[model samples]
Target: MSRNTFRQASLALSIATGLAALSLGAQAQVQEHSQAQRASAFSKAQGHIESFRGRSLSDADHSFEARDLVVDEDGAEHARFDRRYKGLKVLGGDLIVHSGRQGALQSLRQTLNRQLQIDTSPKLRAAEANRIALQQHGGELLSKQPELMIYARGDLPALAWDVRSFQTKADGTPSEMHIIVDAQNGRVLEAWDDIHTAAANGTGKTLYSGNVLLTTNSVSGGYELRDPSRGNTYTINMANRTSGGSILKDSDNSWGNNATSDSTSAATDAQFGTAVTWDYYKNVHGRMGIANDGKGAYNRVHYSRNYNNAYWSDSCFCMTYGDGDGTSLRPLVSLDVAGHEMTHGVTSRTANLTYSGESGGLNEATSDIFGTMVEFYAANANDSGDYLIGEKIMIGRSFMRSMIKPSADGASADCWYAGVGNLDVHYSSGVANHLFFILAEGTNSPLGASPTCVAGNTRVATGNASLSGIGRTAAAKIWYRALTTKMTSATNYAGARAATLAAAAELTATLGSDYSAQVAAAWSAVGVN
Candidate 1:
């Protein structure tokens, strides 16, 4: 059990024991104290409860002080607060304070502090407040221990805290702890322990710290290898999600209690590319990092032994990429590849389009579009704004999925016309990618229209089906709007058509676009409209 858990359980047990003792025989319990001691605490506790039976606001502010009140039957003076509540009268302790809105809470806290005796109000030491929470509801605390609670003063959120699910490194260990703190008053509110574990341990959830085996060499900054000469390994340095900014240091990259080796060149490439991708999203879209919720996750490069794929796991809340057959070819850490995988996170948070059928295809297309945009956004001359997918990371004889011509990657369908969903997401995304290219460059000569692959997924007659190129600027705006607003749980090509229209209309409402028609034609070119 964690320290907080033990603490909360302790408080609850104590409260129960106290209540049971009080009910057993009031006179015997306070036999050493005065009659005043026998009367007030229990009576006051009862009053506090009754007052909370959903009263109104106008009648809520209740304050009082009982003189020489028998705190323990010796007539010891303990402060008293009576809430003749309008809404909830029996409100006390942490939850009551945190649950209140910001403005009213300030008033309420002051009211509580003034009404209750300052000495008896549970003034926790700053160190104790570090992770202890004390909660009293209906005049009874929850844990057996009165001193320490599950809610130590932190984790209180602004009125906008969203309830989230968290998993932990397998071992049946809890991943997240619930502690409610008053944002306004900075007081402990209420908290609960999240009980979950890692997958590898069966009882616990495995936290895969994407650190792959690495070999140290004087040259190439030491690359990642499965069985390098010196048994070296490097871990994917995780980007801190809860905290803001970046921590670039030796301690940050230390993997598995071992010294850092920079992992594979691909890992370094992927990490750097993702960092760039993160910066691009923030710069262009004004997004709050990755999830647009002011949160960004880390990328684990060199994921398994010779693993040849990349995927995002919602359960882990992170992305994992495999090295190319444990060789130099398929590096997921490539620039476009990094952008591609990172975009999956954005799609998950926004559209949440499922990974099957047409929605899957659209989802893949969304990734490709954003991935390409990130590449261009960075203006990295080494990796220009091209329709090609994985130019640097060679898979087989060619790069991973080719957007210019899906068939070039030995998979994807170059243009959308129907039956796009029948293929893989990477290939199926061609239609949308083509449309994006059109939106950016218009019909005559598309921007970065490298070489076209066999348009076999839907139609093979490929001769530069020039969309009334609305330009990538317009395409990006339409995509952002559609993903954020118009899309839902199962977004597909048809959905994309409608969403883009709606997005265009919204844009038209604001920007007054002759550009919307251009967007429509681009969508129509690929069969969305």
Candidate 2:
């Protein structure tokens, strides 16, 4: 059973209703008063909706609905809202409203600034749009009907159809592709996969993290690999199938002997990884679960024969792991790998960064940053914390990616460039990975030496050639804050720099030091400015 219980309650605020005949200052004060009296952050934002919208509140054609809510340590609240025009979802028309501790408006960031003037009437039929999308996708339709949405990401808005389809990739990985087709011409606007895989390439024969502890639920007959404490997050044996699996059970409470020969060994590692990741987010970030709701996600192990990947699917709201070919990889259940996959779910719930281009690179980098944080938080002696990702899963290679100097992997980029977005998301992610490492550990740390793009002659120097880290805890807090509150779907490398700097500014009081300068320097060091 999957515990994806996160839900967004619609606000009853009327778009056409005008505020009382009072000065803007007085009206804002009244809104602030109402916000302080509210219970949850969403409700608080609901009370201040008019103030949040500013001049846009007068636009009766549009309405805003809360998508996510984040409350910071200093009683600051950030609420993300998705815009709808004439009851139709407006793609890329999402915004976040930041409010200070006393409910005063701080700032607002939005993906789209253009006014909506598109005709709702579609010239092409939904079936025709689906056909066009299917022609491009070549996959089974996940939904029978396509939803009509206002596409606002481009220079002008247009009515479009959002189509979802599923297909197995050539590498045996599953793809849940979302395609946006124009209703006016049936032309494909954008397409991306929702099933975020751990690594594009490929995991091994044993439990890499030795003697890890797991929390399982007790049945009348025996104990099952289910965590009652963490949203009933459980692990199941997929039996080498693409879909459906059985929850692992044990006559005795003990699991796996650390050998891949026994199926439970991989399950044990998967369960342990999940538990540690869940704890890391909760203990460090104060997030309750993957979706910040008290619900648990499930895990599927031993998926497909000789399968070489692991991924997190929002549709299934569970993590799926593959048993490797045994020659190259064994089982893809390393702790950092688990953290990386689960953070994708967190990204989906928060920023929902577009899974392509620079935004996609940030999405991947967010996972890598948190994955490293989870490793350090776990502090497992068996699997020591390091900047290397998927180190335990690789056979011949040392690791999948290295954060200290991303270019060490040969394929990943060490720093950002003008056309860096053209690279694959995994390779483009190197820029941000290097930034996070330098921000947290500095240039010449124990992890490894990191070179600036200026030193590499890739770009001219814009800021400090060297940086002093503000430390990992502070860096993680800033990144997490930026990801949840400041970032939108289309935020690019420069936008990421701005978001992190803003995050650092907000965290100054708690962090007891202003790291905004260091954050900017680190981004500049990676040529993001």
Candidate 3:
């Protein structure tokens, strides 16, 4: 089937599910409560625009709209808002306002550190901006409409046109490229792709995890590989194609023998991986699903013939895995990999960290951190929990990455440098990966020995030669809180330090330990201070 046809079918299925869900009284009440909460949060944020803006600007010049509302465990409300100046969207003017349960304002965090005082009118025409962006893109234009918005991510804010283009890689991976063009000067300010992949080098099968229990939905004829308990999250077979696959169905609920020849084996791995990742977030972090909306995201297995990578797409709200070449790598459906890819969706909903530079590194590290945690959470004897990522899928290598010492990958950085952000995000992610390892397991852990920047003679800073860990549970909680509450789209290494420190301080009472010092020391050990 054609890609467009499959997408249409998926949409129809979703619509039908929505209609069926709405017919139920319980689902109706849940929908109503969600809407009511959104409305209330929006109204509360709208009333505090002036206070959040923190400026003397006229209210008419600026307006606020809530994009998402997250209620913390402590009854604190964090409302993320998109800003508009003079009826034009401000790209980097998004902010999150934290409020007490009593509706009292606590604090505000924004992407734009400075006030918006730039001219609204663009000197260049939209058509010219589009042409410039297309010239730089050199690909098919997916979105022809060049939206005019105030770009404030840099040192100075400027009117810009956001253009998106599309292209496919040799391995059948899709790329949705975004180009931010300065409307005043017709310069391509920035460009990035929407598709976030698992590995830079495409590489991945079997009933690798052995016999495992799966949650399947019973249909009229047979049982489908769908988990009704978890928002009906299901797995589909891609038939070695880039797009359009059928849902896996079985005569009985039992799935997969310990072999790779059976197609259902890969499906079993994918389904099991998704289930464990979902449970990890729900039980450990209080996250219902990827978007924390009590909804599940589907998974696509056998994405393409000999394809060696997996990725998460926000546009489809789904995860796609690839069957490996059966040489260096096997299937890319390992438990840690599943957790890593799904965490990308969580990061998108929370920090929405830009996928470039230092923020990009942090984004990758966040996935690696949580991915490892998810693996440990499972405690599967077939696939034992370890800090090494992709160990189960790798055929020759010991693992894809090591959180204990990221430098074991031969490319990842163990310590942060001044120009570390210039490196590829996957490699630069080592700094945070190492920091998390040190924070969770200390410098001399039984798993592996982690060295500090000072021990490595990378920097002469105030760092502990031997640092004690605060345990994985406490460490993961601190990082999760920082990611969901304090971090922003433009957050860098320094911002991450501040966010984690704040999160550690906030949880000190509950943890019964002052993790703030350990968090700070971890950052300093990684040369982030």
Highest lDDT scorer: 2
Question: Considering every candidate listed, which one attains the maximal TM-score?
Answer: 3
Predicted candidate 2 versus true structure: per-residue lDDT over 242-306, tens digit per residue: 87789987777677877887898898888777877877887678776788765668899999998
List model 1 lDDT by residue over 204-303, tens digit each.
Answer: 0011112222221121232221111111112253331222322122212222321123343444454445555665665556454455433346556554
Count backbone clashes in candidate 1: 54
RMSD versus native structure for model 2: 9.7
- Which is superior by lDDT, 2 or 3? 2
Tens-place lDDT digits, model 3, residues 159-218: 898888888887778887778899888888887777888873300123666666665666
**How accurate locally is residue 190 in candidate 2, as Cα lDDT from 0 to 100?**
85
| Candidate 3 stretches greater than 4 Å from native | 1-35, 55-58, 201-206, 455-464
Q: Is candidate 2 or candidate 3 better by TM-score?
A: 3
